[model samples]
Target: MTVQFERRTDRPDAEGRCTIHLRAYFEGQRLRLVTREKCLASEWQTDKQRFRRSKQGYQDANDYLDSLAARVQAAYRQLRTSGIEHTPEELKAALAPPAPAEKPKPEPARMLVVLFDEYRTAQSARGMRFNTLKTLNTSRNLVAEFAAKLPKGLTLAAYDMAIHDRLLGFLRHEKKLAQNSIWKVVKHIKAMLAYLNRDRGMPLAVEPKQLKAEWVDVDKVYLTAAELATLEAAKLPVGLVRTRDAFLFCCYTGLRYSDLAELREGNLHDWSGARVLRLTQAKTRTSVSIYLTGTASALLDKYLGEGLRLLQVMANQVMNRNLKEISKRAGLRELVEVGDYRNGQDGQATGAQV
Candidate 1:
């Protein structure tokens, strides 16, 4: 048998670096194994079977090739001394690095829960809102539950469309959630996976197209002009008065809850005898100028002397609950189906309200 270092000229890496292999010839058969050294073909010496001392890593490559050659020769001598006949494949196997101690496959990477926790921490540090964070936590919990059901559990390497398809089926049949709600979960999953891959330098197993969420068309409901007047004239209880006023102001000026909560007297201006509120949207950070209606102007007048926050904004849950009561008291029981178009209202408006 004969073993020699041969440069592989046909296959080159992305950087045009060619690898050298130990080619074994015996009994009309040949076998080859990579030597884990790479360089330009021009930097190699054909007769010397080593890299020339011309490149940055040439010395280390030469030493490694020498060590590999010694191992192959030792394997050949050992087989002959033992009076055993071996094929080229057997010699190559004998020269291999003792089967690498058979590592336990690296424990199958980390659990998805760990990555989700890190993502939540980073998001909180970046000032995500409480409601948005809460929704993401819900999604993360669902993902954890899904992972627990699997035999191998979840890891970044196992995030593929198969898992996604199964999760969609679980959300639909097992959790009995509608497409819209399931879409929310998928949205959070896509965002978190993107953060891990693009932001945190983790590799994802699935393509971006595989992670796409299906959009749903939702029916929106709005208060008609008559309902608006009823809400304005309704004598709400002391608790709902703030929420009622805020809701009415939103209906008039089309200000989002985030922008309205942060609105102050400083945002109000007299633009050629017209009262206008100028501020940047908290969600998008875009500048906005809202001309006030008569009711909007009156509502601002009521809260003008308030502190840094122009209005008394309650927790989202409290505000939503109180608005439901306000709707009942306004006697606008008619189911009003509204479109998704904002016209000039808040950009995030998409749902229906009575």
Candidate 2:
């Protein structure tokens, strides 16, 4: 087998650049293919199969030709090693490397906010619930604030133990967030990483499991029977009547604000001389049968009777604000202590009232 180079002066371009080609001869057959390199005819050495040393860029052009010849020789050696009979065309084609693929343009540098936007878009497409989306937005805002303080900014591919530890420290020591709240932020970061690596095709440095969610059980504050009675009987302002009624309704029916918002007169059915709520929970999408207490029954009768609109529930934000005011008016101002699990240690917060 023999590989040879030829300069085609007949096809010289306007700039006097001659096309170079490779020829293979084996077993009385010949194969030829054009190489993409171009050089001045005077600079090319047909006999030496390389560019002349005296010409500009001679070293690089000559080295390219040498490597091309070496690849052809290597192909021939490989065929001989395989003990297979092959034609000159097969050997020449084998020697020709496939053209390098055009690389995609480098993406603009991504920040935490950019990825968070993309994540939220994808979640919206998946039909995430409003509350769930709100939670993610809250977490992302905190993440963005934390990322802004970082030296080089947050990158999808740069997440590691150092970033994780620093973020936790920021939330715990600087922000004074509970461990469970920090866990929520970490969960959001994990989801963002998953979207980057799996959906956006970015290579991430850390695994999802590396950002393990550490949760601490927290004792929630609930209105006691006495406190609830005080709230129910307390003369609230005209603006807080709906809020007071809704709070008492929740206490009696054990329904979430979301489920309570979805309640309608149609959902209240008569059963065995008493009223029962039969409705599909908005959060869980599961049907529940709640036997209404006398208070719940009376509230339902007053608000959702005949063709009246479902309980006159206010916006969640408004409801929370009014509830705080009502609680203060009702003199339910005992300092509450909450326990948390932080960094595998027991932590407690005292004199926290809201």
Candidate 3:
């Protein structure tokens, strides 16, 4: 019945570290706990705390301990109410088939480490992006870390949707994760399920398909002709003129930046009349056969001749920066703020600039 969190602020690191610990005592010893460190230097900007690989802080540490207490308390309550006291390890042993009559050939248990490796290999074969793969590995590491805080038998896979909802709800509400971010975690869960079912040959882990993607009403805003013209005329950084053109090419072609980056000379259809670009989109695998529009054609004519990278557009950050400003200048039903609804390319008012 005891659930508690303790915080200890110490000057262990230059940034002022806080040890936030949450532990549950089920049978005298701590059953489960979570501890995290954060930096106080920046007034605890959460994204900064997360994204920056900086030092830890006392307040953030205390906060982590508090959250861990809450989660362990919830988990403990559910176990008590449902009468599910056996750890997954104990349950596994309980569910294990009886010692066979003739002493069957021994097959060792599949270690979690082995399961994780197979999961990564399978994901690689299935075409996961490097970053996506990296995120999955991180999630797996987090799960392992959290499980270790519990007993040896904490089976996350055995948890039902109720637990999933509890975890995600706490993550979104108490932890203040955006819906999109929770969905990012959901993606990791899905990857783990894939590893479990397809790779590990396990059954009845949390079903990911039952989980919905976080809803977001998108306001698609591509540049308009006048806006594009204005953007084209805008001052450039040291070497970003080509990058702008390349992004513009994507705007016209509906190709993602990934597809745009990988397009090669070999894919360029020179044999066609008047410089048509023939290529399949990297993301959707949809083939695009755009027969040179006047401006887009001119861009290809210039860049293809020089043999420069189609993506030499310094970076996507610059593209987004310029686009945001350009949208504001064009005044699309008022300047496009971060969350404002703006018309997408499909239907634009006659004078509307992006």
Candidate 4:
């Protein structure tokens, strides 16, 4: 076996210091092991296989290289004395120091709800949208409630196909959740499990694929053009006027409620002889530019003096409550049938007033 000290110029640290590696060649096989010694490329002597004498601490560094070579020679002689066949990899392993014993790690949080909260916090730190976080919170609460009903309570190790089936049954029968709502809850659970398993390197007791997120297409309800005009003309109490205007602005510009809540006067700018609203969407993190229509521009003009925010958008829950009342007064109370499917069969249809 031939052992030589090599200065690895290809691998340099941020400070431009490269490590000196010990390379061993035996029987046409080679093994490279990194040493604790480091120096600049100019400080190393290729012919001498050591740092230049001009470099400070060159004597000590060269002594370390000599010691490493002695250790390699000792290992090779020991292997030959045993009269056993060995490879370059075996010689490299024999030269390596013993690894330090690992300290015992505190047990990680294993309860399903606790893990859910931890996952939510991680996602929030990564800039998840408020609406999406709210949905995750809801899913966490639903899981907690279902766990409360279990005989032994829910733990990460206890999650399996049986638990998945029971949770679905609880949502469908006990909680009376719609098919799509159940699908969303299931989706959130799978997402949390996937994050824990793949990103955090945690072992999953149950595969997320086994927990299916089955969704059924449902008819979406929205106001017609005639209904929008009627709502615009309808007289409302002073309390509901702001909510009505905000809703109409969304209808005109197709902006999501989250984007409207965050819209500011600075977002409105003159572009190519026309006014446009430009902002990054909260959910998708995508830039959007919408040309202002006559009605949409008029609504913004009405709220011009309302601080830096273009619209005095209220909390989503309160705004939704006010919308129901406003829509009722606007004569948009046509009854509609909302149908859902379950297990590939037609399920119950519910009547809702639009």
Candidate 5:
């Protein structure tokens, strides 16, 4: 049940890599592995693949490596108890850390809080979306929570893969998060690690990857032509009819919900003194031109509200609810099913799904 450590240089196919940092070889075999910080976000310690970098990541990496060392040793002991070949190298490599980088280079001293700000600014410059940035912000909070419990002067680098995996695993398993949701948190951590590597030149022991989870189907109303007609015929609630018209406008113009909600007056023009609706979608930021349908023309001509926009985008949710109700009242529910069952995956941008 004995587990002995080796310098990676002592192992075959792993000589002078310096990246292996730590190892557990069995009776002269590459039994298993443990890792120390070789670079920022690089953890060579555990079976899990990724480790994000932090300013004071070494402290964390060491603690992680130590825990893994214990686990590998125990597993070898268990094999002996079970009468298996307790080869250190074989078992150890199986439990070895994920990766390695160059040793931690020299760096300027700075607070974790300060480095976090730097990371944020750097990622933002990388053209990250707001939602993505928000997730990173959340991951940052989780790190803070863990950091808070540590003694003063403790740096985040003082942690390792075991602790990082524990927290991330909780987010994935306990939170029961979807791929997209988990991706957000992990991406943020990875971004910070990247910053530490490039800016501070810290070597990491792990490279974080996307969660490699699956996306799910969205239950949604895609909209349809017949449903549009039913909507037109059905008697409607007062302002909701306008909202319905706006959503219909979305269907035809392909404006994102945001653009439809925020469209201003100046974006439109007159064709021979007649109104023409034109605006750019906020989501994709693409400009759109729509020759108003007769009904749409009427809504605009009749209720060209003081603002340049046709409908206030603020009330979109209420509008969708009312529109759905209008559809049900007009008996368009069947149409939604018909459109989907008919076209299957071929239904993108079709008026049938809405």
Candidate 6:
């Protein structure tokens, strides 16, 4: 077997660049394979079968030709050692640059619900709050339900404007979810998708930012100072006293349920002769310092002698259920209109007693 470099001056490209080819001769057959090297017709030396010295990078070009020739020779010797009958075509094939590996058909972008679960698992591992994880689980369930209703099923690649519209329709019409509830679900979905895209390197059909939910400010529900005093004084149930105390503490300190659940005696401290509650918020992971009001301090002192946790707060769901009963027993019934808005339009207002 013999191999040599040959510049194709007969067919220069429009840019006057001649393709350098590897000419291989095996037995009596000849084969030519294109080399990646290119140069002008004047830059090639026919007799030496390499680039002229005047050519830019000529030494590198000649070295490449030598390496390619050596590779072809090594392939020929290997074929001879194997004692297999081979053609010039086989020799050329061995010398030919390998076809670019088909880019691994990019691991069929994970199914939407499956990817959501993965995101939830990652968040759980990252020590996300229990309530937040629960919310994510709910979002995953909602997505699975919506996917079940679809004809072709859901996928990250299939998430587009039409799917977005269908999801909103399913939540609003079929599931009969309220505007704020729908917003929360959509927000969770966007968050998961964004996390997958940004952290997991998953491709998204549409930008997460483009998937928008029209959020409306729901009217805040709370008790007035007089009503709060009435409930604080009128509560009588043995089981509900802890729940009421926890709720009253939240009202006094404006702490979220998550922070209230995690509150401990260590969080209470003396600062400049004033007692203060210091804690890092679970959801936002932001540190906060709050000067405890008299009522708040009293509630903390009332719970300090109890079990391990500060207030021994029940699960949020249980506490909420008990709070309703506590409110009814406390005679804190004042009808108030609960207003909700959707898509910049006023939604129906429901009346509830506080």
TM-score of each: 0.54, 0.57, 0.45, 0.56, 0.41, 0.55
Task: State how far residue 9 of model 5 sits from its true place (Å).
Answer: 60
Relative to the true structure, how large is the alpha-carbon lDDT of every model? 0.77, 0.76, 0.55, 0.83, 0.56, 0.79
Give the residue spans of candidate 1 off by over 4 A: 1-109, 120-178, 198-208, 211-213, 270-274, 304-307, 315-318, 335-354
| Candidate 4 similarity to native, TM-score | 0.56
**What is candidate 2's TM-score against the reference?**
0.57
Specify the poorest-scoring 10-residue window by lDDT in model 2. Answer: 335-344
Q: Which stretches of candidate 4 lie over 4 Å from their true place?
A: 1-109, 125-131, 145-153, 169-176, 237-239, 271-274, 314-322, 334-353
- Cα lDDT tens digits for candidate 5, 303-328: 57757666654443355456556667
- Evaluate model 2: give its lDDT: 0.76
Ranking by TM-score: 2, 4, 6, 1, 3, 5
- Model 2 CA deviation exceeding 4 Å by range: 1-104, 124-131, 144-155, 158-176, 220-222, 301-309, 312-322, 334-353
**Which one wins on lDDT?**
4
319 Cα displacement, candidate 5 (Å): 7.4
Ordered by lDDT, highest first, the candidates read 4, 6, 1, 2, 5, 3
In angstroms, give how far residue 108 of model 2 lies from its true place: 1.7
Candidate 6, residues 1-354, lDDT tens digits: the string is 788888887888888998999988888877677888999878888898989887889999889889888898898887788886567766766766799887656566567899888999999999888868987798789889999987878999999888988999999999877786788888998898899889978777888888888877556555799888887898476888988888788777767777787887788789887799889877567888999888888888887878777898876557766777778898866532323334446553322234
Task: Please tell me which model should have the higher TM-score, number 4 or number 6.
Answer: 4
lDDT of 6 at 109: 50
TM-score of 3: 0.45
As a TM-score, model 6 comes out at 0.55
